[model samples]
Target: LVASGIDTNPWCDEAKKQKKGDNKSRKDVPTDAATAAPSIKSHSDFAEDTATEDSDATKESLASSFGKIVLWMGVVAVLAALHVYMSTPLTRGQVVPPGAWLSYCGLLPFDPECENAYLNVNFEGKVIAYNSNRDVAWEMQGDVCAAQVGSCVRGLELRDNGLIFVGGKRIRSIRVPDKSVSITPWPFAEKPHLKISRK
Candidate 1:
């Protein structure tokens, strides 16, 4: 039977062909699986790395913002402390001399020297005159009583009456013969007036 069926070995030929096809399919299967698995793993690794990097960036930004907030808070606190310090009163018997710190209240005059003019300040360092011409004269010192005896001169005024009225203090009479010279008590007060003297 073997010699007669040499050209017609159907069963044996069929078996060999099946084996070759199986080997080819097996090789292709492993190759495709190997390549595909690596690609998927690479993609997943890239996604994880990106997520970690983004999280780190967000944390750093938050930290930077917190630092700036702390810095500004410190600056504001220092400014507030300085303001409180400057506004507080000095202790007992503090001495501030002439041409020293000044504060005043009341209508004085309108002039360049009068602007920001340092008027007669009480011992408490409160300004009492608006238009004070004294550079240093009658400048009160610390511990001195307010309303204590102090001298003050008014700035220039244009009145033909030959008298300048010191608000609340009485009118100062002036003998404007040549230059203007004002004398206190103005011949117009309820109390004993000061002597009218010419400068």
Candidate 2:
């Protein structure tokens, strides 16, 4: 056996086993995978998720903004239509202005053809009232005309809630519209004679 150059030591098998165990231990010490924690995600995957969320949020914001804009536009359009309608002469009753409804309108002989009918009263008087506290009480002076005559109305001395003495005639069931008469003693200070109230 010595001439063949083969040495048979009894501890040689034990040494080989120990070397294998060391190799196994080294292999058990895990690779670089220890740096990758379980909770960690790749940058590309996180960016994709973030981009998707942003896209959804942007879409929602744009939709909400667009909806608000449309709503306001509709409101503005309606208001514009109403303003135009109110400003046009259609609601003016041809000769009467806005903010008043009258009973009748009469024209004087030399009055302009297109004058505000509610502005051309032909009677004159003053309005006085009693407030119970009595100190000469409530008083207003303005001219008034009757709707009895379509051509002209007579003037007279008058008091509010009192009497109308025109040509010594007793006036009954008389109604006056606002802004359509002059309760002063003037030739043109009369009330309009239009059928504003439904009879």
Candidate 3:
């Protein structure tokens, strides 16, 4: 076909050139795919960042709740301390003056089986022997007279040193108000009682 010097086979050479161009385009497809791999990796990194943010938010909420609990506990502790401090009596020493009658009754009033006693103080600030209720007139005795003989007896004597004697026994402490006297007796007594009557 070359010896004839004719252009009848010219379309065959153009077809070969087109086929080479197509092969080059096919080889470029793999390079494009390789370059896109970094974008997929970036998407995974973005997802991890979102998860970290959510975890930080959860930690913050938990910390806030813990702080509130600690604050409330501190407030409760302070209130309890204040309540104890306020309920305690402040005054001390022998405050009951003479002529102040002291009485004690066990459990109930005027019960025959209960321990009931009374102290009658004369107008001269001296203890005197009187009736059971300390209402009847009685002879004045400089010595303290006890209503009952046992440890639960009701008797009061003001000593010279501003101390008190109950049933001829010294008391540890005494609290006296306008119309009542509170005394801490010896170990044998069940509990202290206060009922002051001014005759």
Tens-place lDDT digits, model 2, residues 1-199:
6579877565688899999999999987767675544557789999999999999999999999999999999998986665443333211112221122221112222344522222222333432322113222222234344567554324332333344443234344333333333322221133323222212
Candidate 3 error regions (>4 Å) = 1-47, 91-199
Clashing pairs in 1: 103-127, 104-127, 104-128, 105-127, 105-128
For model 1, residues 1-199, the per-residue Cα lDDT tens digits are: 6777566578789999999999998877755666657645578899999999999999999999999999999998986665433333322222233233333211223434533333333434332322244443221112322354455322221123333223113333322232232211211112222233334
In model 2, what lDDT does residue 38 have? 54
- TM-scores, one per candidate: 0.32, 0.31, 0.30
lDDT measured at residue 6 in model 2 versus the true structure, 0 to 100:
79
Which candidate wins on lDDT?
Answer: 3
In the range 1-199, model 3's lDDT, one tens digit per residue, is 6678867567888898899999998877766667746655577798999999999999999999999999999998886665433222213233333455444442234677644444444444345432345443222233343556554323454444544455455554332332232232411132323333333
Least accurate 10 contiguous residues by lDDT in model 3: 181-190
Model 2 — TM-score against the truth?
0.31
Give candidate 3's total backbone clashes: 0
Instruction: Please tell me which model should have the higher TM-score, number 1 or number 3.
Output: 1
- How much is the lDDT of residue 81 in candidate 1? 65
What's the lDDT of the predicted structure labeled candidate 1? 0.41
CA shift of 51, model 3, Å? 3.1
For model 1 the local lDDT of residue 153 reads: 25
